[model samples]
Target: MDNTKIAVIGAGKIGGAIAIALKNNNLKVKATCRTEKRLKELKSLGLD
Candidate 1:
């Protein structure tokens, strides 16, 4: 991952997709969502 840090604020549909894309590229990803449910969903997708 080259020690790179990426953060996605308000990770909804589009933002979540972007996060996933970056993660699939093996980049460091940090995503934030408004609700716990959404956060759990993102976590389930393997996003941090």
Candidate 2:
């Protein structure tokens, strides 16, 4: 596999869910949210 990294901008409900789905499938994901709290949540979701 190429293992290309994914960048999911705007980590809202849909975006976050997509990021999570990618992560669940063992893909590398990077998501950006509007707030620090949301960003932290994404980190907790296993994102960097």
What lDDT does the true structure give each of the candidates? Answer: 0.95, 0.90
Where does candidate 1 clash, by residue pair?
none
Query: By TM-score, how accurate is candidate 1?
Result: 0.92
Best by TM-score: 1
Residue 26 in model 2: lDDT: 85
Per-residue lDDT over 1-48 for candidate 2, one digit per residue giving the tens place of the 0 to 100 score: 458689999989999999999988888999999999999999987997
TM-score of each prediction:
0.92, 0.89
Q: In candidate 2, what residue range of length 10 has the lowest lDDT sum? A: 1-10
Q: Where does candidate 2 stray beyond 4 Å?
A: none
Question: What tens-digit string does per-residue lDDT give for candidate 1 at 1-48?
Answer: 588889999899999999999999989999999999999999999999
Return the clash pairs for model 2, or none. none
Residue 48, candidate 1: alpha-carbon lDDT: 93
